[model samples]
Target: MSDKYTFLTQAPVHRVIGVMAIPTIISMLLTSMYNLVDTFFVGKINTQSTAAVGIVFSVMFFIQAFSFFFGNGSGNYISRQLGAQNTKDAEVMASTGLFYTLVFSLIVMLLGWFFLEPISILLGSTPTILPYTRQYLGISLLGTPFIMGTFCINNQMRFQGFTKYSVYGAISGSIINCLLDPVFIFGFSMGVSGAAVASVIGQICGFVILLIMSQKEGVIHYTHRRISFEGRFVKEIIAGGTPSISRQGLASVSTIALNSVAGNYGDAAIAAMSIVTRISMFIFSVIVGLGQGFQPMCGFCYGAKLYDRVKEGFWFSTKIGTFFLLFWSVVLIIFSGEVVSLFRDDPEVIAIGIQALRYQMIIFPACSFMMMANMMMQTCRKTIRANILAASRQGLFFIPLIFVLPYFYGLFGVEICQPVSDIISLIVTIPIVWSAFKEMR
Candidate 1:
């Protein structure tokens, strides 16, 4: 198909974007629910179990950062190659990415299993939470390669503009996870460990689905024939992926910091914060879904040197994401207590979570802008600004704010730190946005 006839080119931008985004959004929402399921099941075991789930959550994010680093980096290159009509290059990139993800995930899985204690502690596990954390991490680690490979293939599919198929893989996993959670966690009385096991099984199933899809679509080749690694291509992938690494990596740090800060308030506070994070993430997934829809469009346009189209995609995505997030944020702020109480009914957990949720909601719409900007930059291979903005929200900007604000203002400060950091990050993004606009024009 000619550029003018392509889905990214000829279709009504808004309708086409929605067609691309809705499945991705549904997938994101389902994935978010699994995290909620983690909390819900673990919460039933006791608050400590819930807190343990929270600690292990950070460790999982750390693993995902690496996964995303390769998945996104490779996918970005492949998308551009496709746009440039270099099919062979796209396959090579996808193959190399899969190869790397498998190796990396195996090493991580072994390390997580062998050093569960230290790993849990590093992720901010309190001594009381360590046992549960270890069990949860151990189970999840067993499926690390599957999860990592799934993400890599899913990214490739999305880059190829096969967003619906990517959604199928994610939804299949999430539905299985949702179905198994109660059986494993309560029916068998397996507790936190069961929840982790359910997640592992779900990820493996999802991995199989994605693997089959990739092969049939010819997106990735699992050939025995050796493919020479192009040093420059690897470098490009790393460079392109740096933003995702920073975004997710800093998120891991933020999770640890948030847990440590909440720990000071007691296990109830930790549990409440964990629930709040899950709730907020469920909403944030919509923003991610829309941003992802914009990614391939931006990449393809940029690759084709259609700078105007790239600019249009960025702005249009930003508007759509902000509108949706704004509406959701309002609902969350209005129903903060109800949302928190859904996971755990404790009065103390509800009280702490309400405040956190309210503050987090205030920043949601603004943060959507940052998401759009970052995704656009990544797709266009604008690495430096992308990484800086990506790292800001979680790492440099939020970490110190979280630490210092909590000390001075108590629990309220801790709750407010994320929103504050988000606003500041958006401010920093303004210049990058302007520069991109000027360049594109």
Candidate 2:
């Protein structure tokens, strides 16, 4: 047995999870901070600027949808391969994922530039927000290949249990983004365009670092030679990655729907909801990071036929994730107004955001469970169950709710839709997870 993952197969469950999860949590927090920072600096320009960034976020979601599709899909398979002592297949999967991600991202970038104006309009950009939206979206689309590649490399590293490498890439990029946001947004007077430039630079930086790290001898290396477009490899990648595709793809759809619905009210409504969404994601990153930490462990254990260990890791992650989310939910609930005001202090923005933020916080703990269950299912390659859970929160549940709730309750319905979806998702998750546990038994 290779010393690289003997610890995974032998270490105490708590220690294994902690060792894996902490770096991921930090990486995720840093990544989420970039979005918050962008929102903050852009918010200083005006509500329209902030709202413009929000509109462009739908595009960002689209980028991430495909990125995660490849990243998680390839990463899951690589982890299991490593667990089964198949390094050759793991390398092939890694290279294959990176190759396809770059290719698809290029397609998205071209398509985005081709329909830049129409895309902006479709994303819910108001007339006043269009110029800023165009500037941000145009520059951002240029970095799509780099952004997608970075995410793919990061996920590959994490699945190989080299999450520290993943952190190096993510944190380095976030730091660059943070440092440049002020420089470009105000120092150079680039406004929203500056924010986009800063973001692209940061993503490029991370992409370079990940590429370097992936080249190390013992780590999962990506090579052009290993890049195979063979049908079997492609099928496996899609099969393993379908859950992430559905999850992120639906998330993009939901964001677009939310933006369109919120746009009806005003830019303030869009900005308010946008700020709340970024803040909620910042808090939720901890849960996601923890869940990611659990992923390789689950993948490794399940691949090695250590079903009991997989179950143990799942429950352990659930508890830790629950506690962390509960704690943050309290903090967010208590300081909802202050938190929203930090991004945008306009009274209207703050008022609209605070209530929505609190509603999200109310059901935040439920998200921990749903997220954990989904991660476990995905890691174990429970495709159908995982895809169902992945699609439920944002796609299956939230999509319809976004349309229906706003009709009866007006703006408040829009505000509360996500939390309501989250609660229902939790209910849906329990049975699916229970069934999986029984199967493990």
Query: Which candidate leads in TM-score?
Result: 2
Error of model 1, residue 98, in angstroms: 0.7
**Residue pairs with clashing backbones, model 2:** none
Q: C-alpha displacement of 241 in model 2, angstroms?
A: 0.9
What local distance difference test score does each model get? 0.83, 0.91
Error of 2 at 203 (Å): 0.8
Q: State TM-scores per candidate.
A: 0.97, 0.98
List candidate 1 stretches off by more than 4 Å.
1-5, 217-220, 224-226
Which pairs of residues have clashing backbones in candidate 1? Answer: none
Candidate 1, residue 210: Cα displacement in angstroms equals 0.6
lDDT of 1 by residue, 1-441 (tens): 244227776566777677778878888888788888888877777888988888888877887788888889988997888878777777777778878888889998888888878878877788888888888888889989988888877887887788877877788998999899999998988988899989999999999998777666444555535344779778977988899889998899899999988889888888888888888788888888888887877777778787877777777888878888889889988988887887887899999999998988887888888998888888888899889888988887999998999899998887898889988998999998899888885
